[model samples]
Target: MPRWEPDARTRLEKAALELFAERGYDGTTVADIAERAGLMKRSFFRYFPDKREALFGGTPLLVGHLEQYVTEAPPGIRPWPLLVDALTGTARFFPEDRETARTRHRVVTANPELREREVLKTATLDDLLRDLLTARGTPPRQAAYLVRLALTMYEQAFTHWLTPADPEPDFTECVATAVGDLERVLGEWGDGG
Candidate 1:
């Protein structure tokens, strides 16, 4: 048997992602992942409820950072900027393991079930953002719109940041560029009116 190691959670995640990439998400099993990580099946269950959860288990961390950032932002900060700050703040939770991220992205994108789970996770974050904004005195409708726009920009920026040609290694730069793009688009739209 392979020697036991520390950082069981990280090891399991890396192993699972690799197996998912090799065998496809549906074809991979908990035992396969655990075995690859040199762990027992029960050890895998301790870290993740299922194979899908292994990929998405960090959602709570991301949501928590966003909530904290939004709630603690300077009182006078505008809604859009607050949203940008909150979104960017959550980027730090992503691991710097680019290849693992790429493989996990491929697996999640390829599976319909995984895609649905991803959408659900995004919606949860959207709801959290909306609630945070509303508690800070924004109207419900405006909060909803702001949350959607911010999430859209975040998604675009994250995708751009992950691209091979993206020169910047930091995720925040991509987010800043996305925010600028959003501002330019809105400016053009307002001018056309």
Candidate 2:
């Protein structure tokens, strides 16, 4: 068996999204993707199961990198900070191809099929994050809560990044700011916490 090549997967993703934008996902086919990628149709099938996955090509890779980098973060680091780091570091995973990113975002947002995968991926990462926090010595209950909050912060961060008026950051600073706000709220509500 051959090792997976980032170059190959990236090519497929770029090709798939381009064609989908030009002719709609329903209008595209695997052959179109392969031709766009400048790859053989056989090679395309070797990498992705079908056309839709070409559009979703990088997600599993993104999730794996997040889990690995985040879980490996030093135990001394607080979980929220660790999450911010992980999300930030994972930024490069998406590529600087703005048109591709924006187009893929629109396709994923608009497509029922892609939305289901995105939601499931979120759920899976949330569970993984809770586990990572607990292993870092957060109380199990606290870890679960913190993971949910951090994910919510990430969501806010993503929304802010998408706003046309907002500044561009590889990873949104607003995410960490949201976390700080949450911390302030928790401190104010302290049951001697």
Candidate 3:
């Protein structure tokens, strides 16, 4: 039997990111990631099905969290505010260390396949959020609009939060700022314009 290892999943993730940054995703293998993390290759499979999962393995958990947040929101809360709260709350799911997150972002953005995987993940989240909102009595059109806008805010916030050295603005704060920006833009457009 293999000895239990503490934080093996985190170690594998860090090692995979480092390797992906250094060798490019296509050049990095599961064996390389395991060796870099000082674990067996089988251990990698234990946590992830393949190399791509090193970057995207959290999508399911994230989706579950979002679904739960949307479904459990107060009955009086409107879709837009609920979405803002959900997006801001999701900041907890990401790593606090910005540099590590930046490196992972760089690795993913540099690879077309990884980028496509990312887009697909976003689409999956979009579908899930839309369905959750519609199920909760929000009109289908309103649900789709609010979800897409919220996702755009999330994307903007994520991009801002990844800025190289200026880390004062945390993820939640970034999301808030994105929401503010959206509100400002929409307000400027006015109700009848």
Which residue pairs show collisions in model 2?
Answer: none
Q: Model 2 over residues 1-193: C-alpha lDDT tens digits?
A: 2445458777887888888888887888899888888777788988888888776666777778877987777768887778777876656765575545677878888778878877887898888888877777889998888778777777767666555553465455656666677778789888575
**What TM-score, computed on C-alpha atoms, does each candidate reach?**
0.92, 0.80, 0.92
Q: Write the per-residue lDDT of candidate 1 for residues 20-40, one digit (tens) a residue.
A: 889999899999999898898
State model 3's lDDT: 0.88
Q: Which stretches of candidate 2 lie over 4 Å from their true place?
A: 1-6, 180-193
Cα lDDT for residue 83, candidate 1:
91
Per-residue lDDT of 20 in model 1: 83
How far is 181's C-alpha from truth in model 2 (Å)? Answer: 5.6
Q: Which sections of candidate 3 miss by over 4 Å?
A: 1-3, 165-167, 190-193
C-alpha RMSD for every candidate? 2.0, 4.2, 1.8
